[model samples]
Target: MSEQATTPQDLADDAVVLDVREQDEWDAGHAPGAVHIPLAEVPARIDELPDAEPLPVICRSGGRSGRAVQWLSAQGYDVVNVEGGMKAWEQGGKSVVSTGDKAPEVL
Candidate 1:
């Protein structure tokens, strides 16, 4: 099934929000309950994602997530690029979880 792109608010109750940012960035702050799988590792880690439905991909900015969407879509996975990424989520007033530590290294 084709999965259309969605906003944080449009995410289904059971949908998984995949954060493609590196570990440190994730630890510093991220969408609550987001799953971290660095961009470079996504191809190998694809199995870690849920297969029941499409997943929403997110990044610090929209760029990485959009790239991920392209790759995943080409791979036949049901995925959506979250436009504007975390920036959009923050602007939408969504809650972010912070680890109170140093920021993560951007890969």
Candidate 2:
């Protein structure tokens, strides 16, 4: 939403980062502080989404997140797909964190 290079810390006060990757992918690595809601769970987990604007959505790559953005947009949420997703972030030198004891890595 703000910029394609968005990290958790880079988001504005009213903005939030959503990682729509699966459990395994998320456990592999993700942006620290990002709200995770796997793409498949988005509909049932609608209430879990933060009431924030400019929701920055991401996945392993741009495909899933792009679909999420399209669906969320139709539902009246302000969302944008993070182009290239986590791969772009990792390549861009943005920080990543793991859900387990292992080091962070894009999966």
Candidate 3:
């Protein structure tokens, strides 16, 4: 299956942002409104994702998310790999949500 790539801007418009990082990484910081499902758990947690549109997968440096895109796309789910991941999101002047007791918006 062919997989698409998405930019942070595209993600902001209309897409479900999936953070494939581990719990610790997610707790440290993550994109605001992003869904946290570590790569290790995605196979079992696939049902948690919506079935309507493509979802963008993100990781710290794009590695894990790329793998996720590959895996999910193979499973027939519309998935996009967010190039450059969270680092790019921050570099692109996008917003992130810190995962503390409650996720807080970070400028």
Report the number of clashing residue pairs per model: 2, 0, 0
Model 3, residue 79: displacement in angstroms?
Answer: 0.4
Off by over 4 Å in 2: 1-15
Scored by Cα lDDT, where does model 3 land?
0.78
Per-residue lDDT of 1-107 in model 2, one digit per residue for the tens? 43433443355433457889999999999887589999999999989996657778989878898889889989998887777788887887777888879989999
Collision count of model 3: 0
- After superposition, the stretches of candidate 1 with alpha carbons farther than 4 Å from their true spots are 1-3, 12-15, 100-107
Which lDDT value does model 3 have at 106?
Answer: 25
Please report, as a residue range, the 10-residue window in candidate 2 with the lowest summed lDDT.
1-10
Q: Tell me the whole-model lDDT of each prediction, alpha carbons only.
A: 0.76, 0.80, 0.78
Which candidate, 2 or 3, would have the higher lDDT against the true structure? 2
Look at candidate 3 and give me any clashing residue pairs: none
lDDT of 1 by residue, 1-107 (tens): 23557777776433468999887778777876678899999999988975545778889877888899899989998888877778777777677776666542322
RMSD in Å for model 1: 3.9
Quick one: best lDDT, which candidate? 2
Model 1 TM-score, all chains together: 0.80
